[model samples]
Target: MTSALAELSEALANVELTVPAAPARFLRLEFLEDAPEEAAAADVWSVTLDVSGLDAVPAAGDTVGLLCPNAADEVAAALDLLGAESRADRPCRLSLLPGTTKKAARVPPHLPEHASLRHLLTHCVDLRAVPKKPLLQALRDDAPLVMVAAGTGLAPLAGFLEERRARGQRAPAWLVFGCRHPELDFLLRDELEAALRDGFLSRLDTVFSRTGDRQRYVQHVLAEEQARLARWLVDEGAVMYVCGDAKGMAVAVLDEVVQTVAKAKEVPVSEAKKLVQQMQKDGQYRLDVWS
Candidate 1:
């Protein structure tokens, strides 16, 4: 009686298999802008990454992740600890994960198979990365959108706003942005106001936490507009998108929503919270926050 392995080998001993090579991915860092150098900036460092070897460019509101590789000395030190410094530039086998669907996971698709550490770090990896790579999803063209954010949170939302304008969309959009100071860290203040003047946004509100203003944070701004927000959701079929600090800003914004719903519907806080959860599940409210 032959073993299963032996039988399998014997059945196709003469058969040959051929595999095709995978394409390479390229990234070029084109520009970097720091907040300290610019007025109306919010302590943000914006870097632009140019990508190749992909099927399509990242559409509006989709920012690709780039990782800054370790320095040569750091890499050398780590390699010395492993006692494999000589193999630092060695080639490696390239293969896809087994049993994945045709969709083909594309997290780092710009890398070629059989690459070395130096090649990957110095040449392959780009700008940085997103933890857990959350998918905030795209907004519908048919529905109006309400964007609430602070500081760098405006990064992704800016893409959506511009894309809509480029597509000649005249829908009533709103942006409620918050920052530390208006003259110092009010990100994209001029551009935002331009959009407002262009009739792209029906309303644009800004808040400064450090400035002497009645609206300290975005939550305060939300409360002031609770009646209108409720109407937007209940009648105008608007989508709410919140992006920013997970710890502070996110919590405050959410708490305000819960309170708004509770007062407007005359329900208990617990019931209103449940309604907010349902709205999230129903795609009426979306959050993309990072800590």
Candidate 2:
């Protein structure tokens, strides 16, 4: 694999300190900070360089190859190392080599095509060409849907709501979101409230854990609404989607969901577990979980 540092060096060699391109614009550079635990005494910085120079701009659902001079040189070096470019007068294509490095690029609907926001809300909301087809398809069906998210996890859920609205489908949807604080940490509160006002969302639940003396999370709210959740699951074939904080919050919420299902239905715990598992396998329970 080509090292990012080496690629940076090559980029410095080819391009001036700053150059302008009409079709492909150079975006800002981003330095990602390491997690608090990872950089106890020092700091870890991750740099992301963004550019938009392509034949056509990508759409929300589209993926495109991000090619640049540095990446091209890296591929050329690797090809030469492998003796793949030995032939004379042969045009070398950067993408032909198997191990060539090009960044995986996704087009974000909300972000300006020419500007880059590093680790910010716009950057996080950009849709990439990832394996979310299965999850999207699962949510496309006409069923009651419960979307649980934290922090930036609301991005995709907002996208899903936008998709439904565009298609003129009145899908029954509920959102249960947990954040650090209601006023401070809420990511898409205005947009969600607009959707609610438009009758696009049937219910909206917000949990702010740090606001109260005792922490109250989305799982606690789910427990409080156990009867409603259970009825939706059984009667309307409701699908549940959980996103964000895979290790602590997602796991805790899943445990609470299982317990709530068992308690509300008055079913054996084993049966409730089976039902939840079946729902997952059948694509009725979906997760876009991440840290």
Candidate 3:
């Protein structure tokens, strides 16, 4: 039986399998028993197999196939040897066994060309990890800062603000977050309100594009508070951080900032642009952009 087990092990080792999704299942199964139910039913006969080699990457919602039935039998035999009870009439279905793949969470498709900018912006600010680093770094700089974020882009900004508050670093911070509707689309209203209540954030200006008579955005809010924003920029050496869709929101915010600086400081547009460029060179102006 030991010799047979050794042969089975060798055979199983050489077997190949393909999974249809990301290989998180194989990674997770490393610490789990091959037959958890059997292991629980008979502790003495329990077996745990380390089948990490079967890991494979596949697209979400794809199917996989195991080419070798003999290898599966050997694996089952190994589990059975550990006292895993099996019904001889209905052996475990190989196809039904957990695959080495995993399906990623479903995400909406990218906005179509004909979609409204508001719709595109709404879906652009995914709260995923790819854009968190820059946002967090900007928050940690401990200087007067203006954050402009539109649509779901507020997600990472919210995370950055929360992290700064958690670290007890309450440097004067301002947020200008724009969305389609304050009532229907506010992403982090509670958190922003709590920060305001606790004095973590100095000011929050919300612009709702579809609210009231005229459409408004973060850029509009910045324009409305040009004097205050200019004071923060020129007097306090405030940093500016913008996060959101890269297509229109970023460009529009930058243009609005330039215009606001020129109008408020009574300087030429070129001078305002140069001043913003200098701020960027000095690490006072940072952008975390994503499509």
Candidate 4:
């Protein structure tokens, strides 16, 4: 990444965790729905929390990191071996995958000596904006959008679309999601299809790779839908948002988007690549990917 691009990403990205000024409160977690996008991939669940005791509840697109208590369990088991003074509050860092566009925050020691399993759970928020901030913002003006996601990366975009629908926004949008299996891991399948039914989502597409002999991905779906994608970008001025595995899915999807631009404008591949870079610089092409 260029220095300028790195700077822009840092300026626009933030990670906030629940602080230790006050002891953490235990809130109930409610399971809403689970949308499996891939059978072998992690399942994306739409769960609701009883955030009544929290200082402030995380809004849509915000993440809640549930810190495991295994370490705490070990600590308690050895409490007799280690004296009280040795048990001084220690901070735990919840690190996300490292990237130029990413950062981490410490999980505060916000619990009592006998903190329970619930107290160990922490909330790591993205204070600046959700990964799909640009797409959500575009809905305020009802701008056209193209959202592409794979596996569990569908969480933020699904939340954004749900919020838009709740607010009665009529932004034309397309969703191209890729996963291992639709039946087992098509997260938010019902909600997305409902959005399409109600006219909130302009189009919806899905790819299940493991279901067939050939391995297909979301980028393949993007290539198949290049005509619509080209029109969305070159003609309608639609913004693009991609969230998925950075190593493979995100890279391939980006290549296809750039190629779509080049094909639509009949420009050299180099020029098209630059146009994609410019879009990222301008925050029109946003990505939230992890290895």
Tens digit of lDDT per residue, candidate 2, span 86-114? 54234322223455565664444433444
* TM-score for each predicted model, relative to the true structure: 0.71, 0.57, 0.53, 0.63
Count of steric clashes across candidates, in order: 7, 2, 3, 5
* lDDT (10s digit) by residue, model 3, range 89-199: 332222222553546533333324344322222333332224333423534456787889987667656666766676776899999998776666677688899998888
Which lDDT tens digits does candidate 1 get at residues 199-277?
Answer: 7777999988765634389999999999988777656868888999999999999998888788878899999999999
Q: Which prediction has more favorable TM-score, 3 or 4?
A: 4
Q: Give the TM-score of candidate 4.
A: 0.63
Query: Ten residues in a row with the worst lDDT in model 2?
Result: 115-124
Question: Pick by TM-score: which candidate is best?
Answer: 1
* Model 4 accuracy (lDDT, Cα): 0.73
Which residue pairs collide in model 3, if any? 20-58, 21-58, 45-82
Q: Candidate 3: list runs displaced more than 4 Å.
A: 1-141
Off by over 4 Å in 4: 1-45, 52-58, 67-139
State each model's CA lDDT, in order.
0.79, 0.67, 0.67, 0.73
Top lDDT prediction, candidate number: 1
- Model 4 Cα lDDT, one tens digit per residue, 103-221: 54433444433443223332222222324333333334557888999888887888778777877876888899987876777788889899999988889899988777678999998
Those runs of model 1 whose alpha carbons end farther than 4 Å from true positions after fitting are: 1-57, 73-89, 100-107, 121-130, 213-215
**Lowest-scoring 10 consecutive residues by lDDT in candidate 1?**
33-42
